[model samples]
Target: MNRKTLVLPAVVGLLAPVLAACGGSDSGSGGDDGAIVVGTTDRFTATKDAPAPFDPAYSYDVGTWNVLRQTVQTLMIQPKGDGDPVPEAAQSCGFTDSGNERYACKLRDGLKFSNGDPVTAEDVKFSIDRARSIKADSGVFALLSTIDTVETQGDNEVIFHLKTADATFPFKLSTPVAGIVNPADYDKGKLREGFAIDGSGPYTLKTETDGDAVTKAVFTKNPEYKGVLDVKNEKVDMVSFEDADAMGAALDKGDIDVMTRTMTPEQIKKLSDAAGGNKESLVELAGLEIRYLAFNTSAPTVKTKAVRQAMAQVINRSELVSAVYGTQAEPLYSLVPASVTGHSNSFFNTYGDPDPAKAKALLKEADVSTPVKLTLNYTTDHYGAATKQEFEQLQKQLNASGLFDVTIKGTPWETFVPAERKGQYEVYGMGWFPDFPDADNFLAPFLDKDNFLKSPYKNGDIIDDLIPQSRRVADRLTAAKSLTKIQDIVAQDVPVIPLWQGKQYVASSDDITGTAYVLNSSASLQLWELSRGVSG
Candidate 1:
């Protein structure tokens, strides 16, 4: 738990080639004192029922973690490219037992948070124990569930005892869930309520808020920090936009140095067309983010495998990607995206291009009548404005086939999340941004018995055998065979239908340096990597 340098995986290598050219510059304005300005539509909002989004115990989304990665130091940090986590707060960390259950890390000699409090083993223990004990619904309790107990060894070292062998435990420590906070600034049982942040990261953050919404977060380089990251910029101003159009416009008008997160397909196309003027302005990186549909297996409508498989056969991914997303995304054929270590196009292999004939044949074979009824649900506000168009396109495709009756419904994200979680929807939409960069992260969350999807998707081979087997291997690539088998099983069962894979695009004013480094394969932005300068 104590901040220490731990090893990470080689997931970065998967995207490094595409990101190699992101560091160059062309022409654009720079912030004062070499500071950087960033625009994003990703809002970190806190609700009355949920804890403060800034608190590590409560913050579960990618947007909040993007900011937290800059201000709050984890025990280990994932470096920019192809390697394990280097020592930031901790000097060294690794599994101490052959079973991979006992992990330990020794803190650096003189590590301190922004508050000047010494980073110690006890603080690490308190942080982990408090997070596990709170178990807030909004918190990442699932990620920390593997830890059986935390014990401190002297003032500089901390040890973790796990319930089972988990080779992915080290990667978990590199996430914001394992972010080490100052014990004094946080309570043992409650979430941190205010905007004030104290941590051992490379920068210190101050926020500008309107009511509960954060408008901007100003990050100043922490002079009293010690970490593996090289602080490239003296200051960073992260500005939040209500929508992607405004954010895109800000980048065009030079109001912001960089634009990221959610941009409309139209805006992306515009930028992509304009990229010929200055190619470096549009920085594209290999992304692991994906969008898919989750079917409630227990629901009366989509419960049968024949119905789900037929729908899968009828849903044309190529058309969906072209009409809805344009060139913004690619058709994803598997639960595990192509960027991950072990990815197979099991769905594509089973059912080729959209075949209404095959779909009708499937239904006939199963003794089901034509024009089967199905309600496709999607969120109107959460993912992006394009979501509405995406589902409408799906409805068109399904209805055009004349093989089924499909009704497309749209709901606000606030209501959609709870409704889907409670299994109120027969078939609903979901998007995944990985908690870590690995094949296990892509599979375990949905295939497990107690999955986040809340769908009745339980496979004994996947949940009990394949998943556990995959996690036991330290080398992630070696576990690809097992991961492929798990994907094959899910494809056959048709619990979830893979839709499209997303690519990370950050449009920066040509003057911005390190735009490529701003986001990793996991799609988490490291603000410290952004600096004001002309690219080569």
Candidate 2:
């Protein structure tokens, strides 16, 4: 539920810093000759919601985590297969108890921060505790909410005491939220103030800013990095842009080696439409980012179950994706997207297709009158400019049915986030970039009592029973029944309507290699994988 504005590539919690320098790269300075300048619209501003943008405790968006995952080393890394997490900073980690409530890990030998500080068990404990203590409203603290306490066995070992069994705990540890930081530089109580990153990951990040806006983030391969990743590039430069237009232009002009996260739908169409030879430059990965409309179930216009169900039945997801997102997204039938392991086509199986007759039948059966006035709220900045087009299309579809008289409203990301949290909108749009690859990461965050939506969706059966039961099994595939049931329950309740799932697109120069390797299954970007000097 890392909500980001359009052009803001919503990552879990990886982000760079805000500083000042000129935007984009100089023309004729790209290609196989120099550092791979990857262009993006992701900004790492230190705001009220994200006061500590670089600190693992505060940052919780994909844009931020994209950078954090490069600079900070986590206890474990996401496995390439469906098996449990593999070792990174930790030599190994697993449940030490039969109940799965106790977990322990031993740090790898010769682990050190980029600053030469020893990566000790105390540092690991401090990092986790600091994140929990700060617990920023926008932070990933909710992911770490299960931790009861932390205890160190020695300099190399750390143990976590959980309140209950959590099978997803290892997956959570693979996220950037558990990114270990050097205790000497990072204060336990507050966010470290600076654009500089001091961690032991594959890259050591340094930002060049023009005033407060970060123009470029320079990632140098960390010689001291001791992790599962094999650093491929010597240096990779991330150039920031204000919009897709500028970023796309930079890519076309060869001012940048690669452009990712957000190219406009039109830009994506142009590249995808490119004939024969030009197609080699565009790289696409299976993405987990999902866009959906969350019902303020307590709101008057959509308070009834029938009203929400009718709205869901009437939404044509295929039309919405094709009309607005083009090749960039696909129609999604479940909150847990199809790219995820436990995803189920519950909505498609339940609603079948967009049927105005059925929608009308629902309204009539509920004894509800015609032209039910509803306001569709969305953010102008988050999710891209296409969001407005999407909502307008939604408005058109609902109004044409003669059942809903819909008014669309738009706000900036700044106001939308807090307002959504307060349940100020009847039905607002939101995007979720996974905190981990599991389906639990998608279902639990929106359905829990401490859900990001803050809607009246506290279902005891789903939360108290299904979610906990799902989390008790470490093999994610084994928990599919519970996850599928949760999605079915969500579809029945109609608290949220799954709209579209995004595809990760990376447009790079023909000379750039390893663009496909940049993103993991969870869509976390590994900048080190991108290298220069490849033939077209």
TM-score of each: 0.91, 0.89
Model 1 residue 254 distance off true place after TM-score fit, in angstroms = 1.6
Residue 216 of candidate 1: its Cα lDDT?
88
lDDT of each: 0.79, 0.80
The total of clashing pairs for model 1 equals 7
Tens digits of per-residue lDDT for model 2 on 322-353? 88887678899999978567889999999998
What digit string (tens of lDDT, one per residue) describes model 1 on residues 431-460? Answer: 888887788888887877546676677888
Each model's RMSD to truth, in Å? 5.4, 6.4
Q: Show where candidate 2 strays beyond 4 Å.
A: 1-28, 31-33, 79-84, 192-196, 210-212, 276-280
